[model samples]
Target: MFNVPMEVLFKVWRQKPHQSPQLQTYKLEVQAGNTILECLNRIKWEQDGSLAFRKNCRNTICGSCSMRINGRSALACKQNVGQELEMASSSNNGDVPTITIAPLGNMPVIKDLVVDMSGFWDKLQKVDPYVSTQGRKIPEREFLQTPEERSQLDQTGNCIMCGACYSECNALTVNPEFVGPHALAKAQRMVADSRDTEVEARLETYNQGTQGVWGCTRCYYCNAVCPMEVAPMDQIGYLKQDILDRKDAQSSRAIRHRKVLIDLVKQGGWIDERKFGVFVVGNYFRDLQGLLSLAPLGLRMLSSGKFPLSFEPSEGTKEVRSLIEAVQNHD
Candidate 1:
C-alpha cells in the first residue's frame, strides 16, 4: 500500500524567549508517511521561514525533536502524520483532523518548540547517574560483567535523554525538589551496575527525603509517555524496594510509612489509622517532634468524627495475610 497525500491542519505553538505562547495555525499538504519533524521542516522552509523548532539527525536516536505532540510528550522524528491524524480522528469530532505541536512541559520554553533543559540535566546529576570508581584499585584490565548483570542495564540503557518522561511527570508539577523520573530511571541504572562500587551510598542518597525516590507520586505518566519504554516509575519502585530491603523501618519517615502500612494491613486486613500515625510520623513515641506534629491532624480527625477509635479485621483477613505472605516469600 502507498501513503496518500493529504492536507492537514497544524496548530503550532509560537513563542519568543520570555513571551506568552500562542497557537499559530498552518495548512500543509503532506504525505501520510512524513514524520512530524518532516512536516515541521517543510513548514519552516516553505510556509513560514521564521517558525522555530529544534531538529538534528531527523531521527529518533538524537532525541532532539522531542515535543508535546497532540498533548502527549513524544519524539517528533518517530511519530508520523498518519498516526497523528488517526489519533485525532478517534478523539476529536471536529471537521478537520488537527495536530497541535508544542514545546515540552515542566520547563521554560526557549522558542516555538524548544525548552530549556538545564533543570532536566541538573536533576540527572543529582542522582549520580554515572558509575562511581572511588575507593577502587586501578584495574589491571577491563572490568567485565556477566551476561545477566549486563542485561539488567538494557532497559534503562536505551534512554536517549529525550526529556519526554520528565515533561509528563506529574510529581514535578507540584514538587520541584522531587528528582524527576528521568533521573530516577538513570539512578536505577547505576544501582544495577555490577562495576559500580557505591550501591549502599547510592541507595542512601536516593532514600533521602522527598528529593529522591520517596517523592514520586507514582502517577505513571512517565511510563506512558516514554518513547524508549524506560518505565521510570517502575524503576522508582525498584529503587524503593532496594531501600526497604537494606534499611530498617526507623531509618526515615518514608521507610517507616511503607513498613508500617504493610504491617498494619497484614494484621487487620486494612490499615489501623489510629496506630498508623503514631508509628509512622510519631516514630512509635520515640521522636518528640514527630509526636507533637501529629497532634493537630489527630485533633482535626477527632473533631470531624473520622478517627478510628477501635480496630477490627476485615472478612477473609486470613486469606489476605496468606496473599501478603505469599508475595513476600516470592520476593
Candidate 2:
C-alpha cells in the first residue's frame, strides 16, 4: 500500500488462437507494490471482464500466471509493479511508464494471456519421463538412496511443468517435433535417478535426430526465461554428457561428434581438423558412406585454401593437456 496510486498505462495483447492480435491499453491508478497479476485482475474486474488469462495458486508455486511482461517471460505474481516501474525508468523514459503484456511465445495463444500447452505436454510425453517399474516385485517399502544420490534429482524435480522454457525455446520455433526444453529437463531427472534401470534404452531414444536432446540449438533461451531457474539447457547438456559416458554413445553421430571433439582436443591441445570428420561422421574411418559424404566438402575447402593439410601442436600444448587432464581426473 502507498499514500496514493500511480497512474500507469497497461498495453495488453489481445487475441484468440488463429486470430489477429490487438493492443489494448488501459489507464489505471495503481500503487508501486502491485503485482502484475493484481493489476490484471483489477482490469478484468473493473474495466474489461472479458479479458481472459490463467491463475491458480496466486503464489509463485502454481505458475499459472506465467506470461510475457515487457517482452520477457516471468511469473506475474513474483514481479512487482515497483520493479517494472524501475525497469521503465532505467530504460531512459524517466516519465510515467507504459508497460506491455503479452502471451508466452512459441505456443498458440488461446485468448489474451493464456496459451494452448498441448504441444508442450505432448513433447514431454514423448520423452517417457519416468523410471520403468518392471522387473521388480512390489515391496512393502520405499526405494531408498543416500542423500548424495538423491541430491542430483532435486534440481530437475523442482520443475512445475509451467511451459515457460517451452514457450521461449528457439528450436521449437523452427522444428515442431523437437522435444522441448521442459521435457528434456524432466528427462534428465529420470536419467539421473538411481532407481531408473532403463538408462541405455532411454539414451538411445533421446539420441534420435531432431526428435530428442539432439534437436536443441543450445541457444540457452530456455535457461533465461525459466522463472524457477530450472536451467533446462544445462540439464539437456548433462543428459548428453551422461549418454556419452555410456558404451553406446558412439552409436549416434551427435554423440560421436561431441566425443570426438573432446578427444581430439585432449590429445592435441585443440582439434586436429583433418581427423575430426572421419573419426566422428565416418565412425573412426569405418563408415564408407560418411567418408564419401565428406569428400566433396573436403575438396571445396582445399580448393578455397581453408583445409588443414598438416597438424601442428598449439603453443603451450602440454599445459593445456595438463589442465584437461586435471578436469578429467576431478570428474
Candidate 3:
C-alpha cells in the first residue's frame, strides 16, 4: 500500500499563567490516515504535556473538537490533514495547509480549544427550548404525530450545539445581543414541533427585540458551517413567514421594508430609491428630522439631475409581477 508522508505544522494557541494569547507552532510527521484531532493528541501526549484541548467522542457527533482549521470552522476529528494538504498544494495561491486551531469565535475562550458556553446556554435559556405543556399532564401513551408534522421538528433537531454557525455568523459579530443561530435553530425546532403548545409565544419571543429574527442579515454563513445541515437562514425565513401569516402587526418593520422594495421592483422592474428611502425611514412630511438627515445627499443627487421624483415602468414589469405571484402561489 502506498503511504502518504506527512510533516505538517500546527499553529496552535498557547495560554500561559497571567498572559494574553500566543500562537505556538509544532511540527510533526503524521501518517496518511491521521486526523487533525489525532495529531493534536499526539502532540499533547508525546511532545507537550501542558497542551490543552477538548476531545470526547472522537466521532463528529460529539462536536467537542470544533475549531478553526485553515480559516474555516470544522470539527477536528472529521478533518483529514492529507486531503487538506493536497487541496492547498493544488491551489494557485500556494498557501500551505497550516492548521491554525483556535477556540470558536463569538464565545469566551476558557483554555485553548475550549470556549465558555455560558453565553450560548444563556441565550438558549432565554428562548425556553423545551416544549411546554402548560399545566397539562402527560398520558402514558406517546404523542402521535403525522410523518409530515414530525419531519418539521426533526429537520432542526439535528443541531449538535457545535458553535460552528455561531463562529461564522455576521450578525453575532455586529449585534452581540442577538440570539445566535444555534439558539434560533433550537427555538425553531420547538416552534415547529406538533406537540408544542406555545408556538405563538415562542414566535413572539424571537420577533420582539433587536436580538430577534430581524437582526439576522441573511448572510447564509450559518448554513455553510452547520455540521448538522440545519439551515438557520431558512428557519429565520420560515419564522418571518409564520409571523406574517399570523399578522403579528407589531413586527412589521422588516415586512414593510420588504413590501416597499417588492412593490418598487414590481412597478419598475427595479427598486426606486426615493420610494424605498421614504418607506424605510418613513414619509418625508411625517418625519422631517429623518428627511433632513438625507437632505444633503439628496440635494447633491438633485444638483446632478439624477434624483427623479418617480421612475417610468420598466418593459418587463408585468412579467416580474407574474413571477412573484407564481412563486407565492406555489409556496
What's the ranking of the predictions by TM-score, best on top?
1, 3, 2
Model 2 per-residue lDDT tens digits across residues 45-106: 99999999999898889888999888788888888788887776343234657888999888
- The 10-residue segment with the lowest total lDDT in model 1: 88-97
Q: Candidate 3: what lDDT?
A: 0.78
lDDT of all predictions, in order shown?
A: 0.90, 0.85, 0.78
For 15-106, candidate 3 gives per-residue lDDT tens digits of: 64355889888888876578889999989998988888788998888888888776668888888777556555332223334666777788
lDDT per residue as tens, model 1, 245-276? 99888788999999999999999999988999
Clashing pairs in 3: none
Between candidates 1 and 3, the lDDT winner: 1
Candidate 2: the clashing residue pairs are: none
Off by over 4 Å in 3: 16-18, 86-97, 134-136, 139-141, 248-251, 283-289, 300-315
For candidate 2, the per-residue lDDT at 304 reads 100
Per-prediction TM-score? 0.92, 0.87, 0.88
